[model samples]
Target: MSIHLENFKNNLKLRLDDNPQLHGFQTFKKTLERDYFSEVSIRICFKEAAKTENLVIEMDCNLDLLEMLYHLQKGTWGGNLSEEEDLPPNSSFARALDQLQELNEISIDVEEFSLFLNDCSIIVKKIYSNSIKDQLGSILSTIAEHYVYFTKGLSETPFEIYVPVFEDTIPENDYTLSKIREADNQTKDYFGFWGLYFDSEDDAVIYDLSNKSIVSGDLYLLNH
Candidate 1:
């Protein structure tokens, strides 16, 4: 079950066209042959500077998982991780995997995976799993939680990744400001922007900066 590459490209283009901020970006896809898993590489570039500063997303997955994503996106699969359950029981996709496991065609392990952005690329590692249930859970969870970051051009809006802090140890109004000041100093000292961090509760709190007492949301010499 290979990925439907053409469908993926068409759908992605539609998604990008719907967002004005994403108009500057263009997408290109490449397939890679690998012994362990299939690979689909999608490179997103700013239209004005297509040659350099491209953001690449590499998806590495086995045949079954590849098919799963395709089906999920197409709405052929019943499972939707945006629901409350981490892994929905009613998914025929999971049941099919279970059948394959029973036949010994595939063996599942405890799913372990990593998702990180570094050096202008986002990498989604293949989950190593022996349990089909755990593997399904992890895959669905990742898509539900982080798919937006991949679709949205994070490079254009670096502040989208900013986290705010409101700690009891620090004054309510000054917490985020203090953290930014600290980061600004580190950026000067290191000759590169220090990454932003804040209270865990502030993850993706992307509204009303004035209320948060944030005077500025600028990245100088920041690395992706």
Candidate 2:
């Protein structure tokens, strides 16, 4: 999904503004566990070296984002981004991301952590390189490495996003879930969970969060 830094900031501000006491926006990185996964790319006109620099800037940018998130939630800035950062527009952590804007670099202004940031303002969070690159690794692990697209700010926090329907959430008679114990059933009737293609080998490996599902085909819910 395309990300708008201003949109995120505005939404977050609105949410935080409405619920002033709700200081922290806790978003998990468990999206990888869902069945539906998509690729993310930037319209970067830079070369390989630029890519490297972009990566570095991304690194610092995330650090600052996280530090600020933590501070915002904790009600203190402390000294999180005090060190030299590798994010774009090299500068001290304190001066990196302008609160006026959601992101400082915004790589192609592309975003992967969009779902997590939806309607939630700044909370305790961190952005990382490995996490960004590898956040979808688990999803890719189930499929071909070359088939997926990882985005610039994929991993915004060390925590994982919550699966829409966790294994623990699967209550008996839930309709979608039949086999409770080691429940492994695959058939044309599997229509409850987020329908995901695990590998190129076949369409049999429907994605379930670790074992749960992402409430597949619920794009309609996004409206709310």
Candidate 3:
């Protein structure tokens, strides 16, 4: 009596429908469109693996768009941070950027991401716990709750589908670009840009922003 793919979809739909507030999202089909230097739409979709049978959540976001948007919103495009005029603390854009910065400070684990979505294709076989529905519901709720803010964050590098990775994981370098192209080939598995290797069961991990490599530890620098 294991969970099936259909069970995951049904349960997820039920979870979203149960919450009346999320009706505006239209079951995650709607994309977030914005124009800073150019028009960009944050599109989300669901796909299941044909062979490995993994649930694949796909998001279309570009790092350049996010960086430009941040600069335009914050007025930090050509000048240093100190020279830039800051927005009010309560501004939605400012607040969203703050949250995004916080997310970047601590690397998020693939097993634990605080974001939501409307539709998801989850491979039942990959889920290790019995509370699969509950897990999906929580994740979706988080996504829907901060949909706009999360969209802003997604416009950044590494382009988090759920979990956040390093900026170097982007296709700027040959190594990373090759990896990205290869990932397109393996559509069945979750292709995390930066693989996590925990040295212990500690809550903290050292994140090096310079080289974009993570070292598990408690006291780590927020920036290089």
Instruction: Give the whole-model CA lDDT for all candidates, comma-separated.
Output: 0.30, 0.24, 0.27
lDDT of 3 by residue, 15-60 (tens): 1112212222232222212211212222221234312111122223
Q: Superposing all C-alpha atoms, what RMSD in Å does each candidate have to the true structure?
A: 17.3, 18.3, 17.5
- Model 2 — TM-score against the truth? 0.20
Backbone collisions counted per model? 7, 14, 3
Better of 1 and 2 by lDDT: 1
* Candidate 2 residue runs with Cα over 4 Å from true position: 1-41, 44-110, 113-132, 144-206, 209-224
Positional deviation of 35 in candidate 2, in angstroms? 26
Error of 3 at 156 (Å): 15
Best by TM-score: 1
* Cα displacement (Å) at residue 149, model 1: 5.1
List the candidates' TM-scores in order. 0.24, 0.20, 0.21
Which ten contiguous residues of candidate 1 have the minimum total lDDT? Answer: 27-36
lDDT of 2: 0.24
Rank ordering of all candidates by TM-score, starting from the highest: 1, 3, 2
Q: How much lDDT does candidate 3 score? A: 0.27
